[model samples]
Target: MERKCNNLPFLLLMQTSKVIHNQIKEEMAKNKLGITEFSV
Candidate 1:
């Protein structure tokens, strides 16, 4: 139980970042931007 609890937040953070990453990719695609262009 202790190990599972410790990993819970890490898993949640990864999932949240995945969602945000997908959103950014979609936005970049809509704007016809490359990764480097989007980062600026």
Candidate 2:
């Protein structure tokens, strides 16, 4: 339990980073779709 507690912050940071990255990827994909539609 002590070891897990020590690593809790790092684990939370990684999880938050993954969430932000995924959101950014989704937004980029949406913008790309708009660009493609405009070109067509």
lDDT (Cα, tens digit) per residue for candidate 2, span 1-40: 3545468888999999999978867876877755456457
- Output the lDDT of residue 31, model 1: 97
Task: List the candidate 2 regions with Cα displacement exceeding 4 Å.
Answer: 1-6, 33-40
Candidate with best lDDT: 1
TM-score of each: 0.77, 0.65
Candidate 1 lDDT over 1-40, as tens digits, reads: 3544468888999999999999999999999999899879
lDDT of 1 at 22: 97
Worst 10 residues of 2 by lDDT: 31-40
Candidate 1: segments with Cα more than 4 A from true spot: 1-6
Q: lDDT score, residue 33, model 2?
A: 58
Worst 10 residues of 1 by lDDT: 1-10
**lDDT of candidates 1 onward, in order:** 0.90, 0.76
